[model samples]
Target: MFKHSKFAAVAILAISAYHGAAFAQDAADPVVAKVGGVEVHQSELTLAMTGLDPQLANLPEEQKRVAALSAIIDVKLLAADANKEGLQNDETFKQRVAYLTDRELHNAYFKKHVVDSVTPEEVKARYEKEIAAIEPQEEVHARHILVKTQQEAKDVIVALDGGKDFVELAKEKSTDPNKSEGGDLGYFTKGRMVPEFETAAFALEKGTYSKEPVQTQFGFHVIKVEDKRKQAPPTLEQVQDQVRQLVMRDKYVKLLEDAKAESTVEIEDPALKKAYEEVNKQQADQKPQQQ
Candidate 1:
């Protein structure tokens, strides 16, 4: 019962798009199955395949086709029986059909206006604006010698001060996996490390190691700062998809706000109405208009 309901919901969601798409080709979608004198065409089978539950979607391609065909056959048989019983004429079914039709139309409009309307130039502009707003942060390229005991960390610091190579000492004394690379942590900003370690590392000048061991949850660290510089912004290609989503969201919110302003929305329950208003208020507070 639950499975059937899920498929019905998916089919309803696809209805408008399917209808618009069905006219694109003049070639016939041959009848693949029949039930109670009702024929199921290839187009209907394709819709059924598109609407399969995610769990069933993972099946082999041929098996997926067979499963979709089976589901469509069942739907046809049950629909024919319902029609025979005049269930199609029932008021409840009529109301449901109306709601499903409106929902599908809503999806079609959203696809056309929000999804299709987004352009590459708009995404790039949004990315540039967002990137410009980010404050530059200093990042450090550092290495460390991590040891189980503070005394061990102190010994490593002594090794550094005595002009022993940090990388060799790290490989010999440190327990961290990066010890093989001389405990190289590459470049990172302050928030990336624990408070104690970050404070100690950031306090050091380039080319200096901590004279004393710094303790943290990971044990003790003999820290050094190899270099420090401003962090770089991500490449456009790396953030293009995310920026496109931001563009879509902004468009959707504007459409909803305009629609809400023109329409009457009344919640009969006072508590539910209050909750709805609060949600809208929170959304408004969280994101500023992109422009």
Candidate 2:
């Protein structure tokens, strides 16, 4: 499956915290501490909390900020020594800094162009379009009297034939944990049960009990079909978040395509180039081909 880079997820987390810091800066961004004459911004606390030790995330919020402050102070103390030693001038360190800066920029761009651009109306329209394409499925509401042996199952069918109340009979004779609820499985579509049980349940007419015992890995069942109807689609409220993710994914792909069109990418290694093309193909495939 195609997916955005893991770095993108980290970037999103970092950018989201920074986004909040914008409006909350005056109230929340004041200097909480100083290290070696350098001020520590409350905004830095967000990066420290997210980018530093993973353990800090488990700490209570106030304690987390205090730890992050201490950690950042320690980093500054060592970073000052590294700077004094001219480590920042080293070629490897410079390259690492450049790469990190580029990654952070990419993350911020992704957040601004892709994540923030998704709207509720677009998500709802996409959801409705997807839902409309699906075929409605038939589901059955069933109750089953399960027993250890075929004879027990057959006897339950005979009792049902004698017009015994299915619910009361299930409570009296079934060993299932749900026996208290009359062996009621409620409503389910096909493929939700063992093949034997699902087949028998769907085959029985509504309001009728299976004439014969149905055997499955669970033993024998005397299933009674209570009702059948078209399974209802999930409500928009139940799946809005997921549909929003789909909208974001499509937008990200479009953004990538636009950027790729404007840039020059030359790969000298043939094998690496082929592999890169394959990955891009997957990304391209994630969006439907332009009509």
The Cα local distance difference test for each model comes to 0.91, 0.89
Error of 2 at 89 (Å): 0.8
Q: How accurate is candidate 1 locally (lDDT)?
A: 0.91
- Name the runs in model 1 displaced over 4 angstroms: 1-28
Q: Write the per-residue lDDT of candidate 1 for residues 13-78, one digit (tens) a residue.
A: 799678767755424677777777777788988889999999997799889889999998888788
Cα displacement (Å) at residue 255, model 1: 1.5
As for candidate 2, its clashing pairs are none
What ranges in model 2 sit over 4 Å off? 1-28, 289-291
Residue 277 alpha-carbon offset, candidate 1, angstroms: 2.5
lDDT of 2 at 172: 100
Q: What TM-score does model 1 achieve against the real structure?
A: 0.84
Error of 1 at 121 (Å): 1.1
Going through the candidates in the order shown, the clash numbers are 0, 0
Error of 1 at 44 (Å): 2.1
Q: How far is candidate 2 from the true structure (C-alpha RMSD, Å)?
A: 13.4
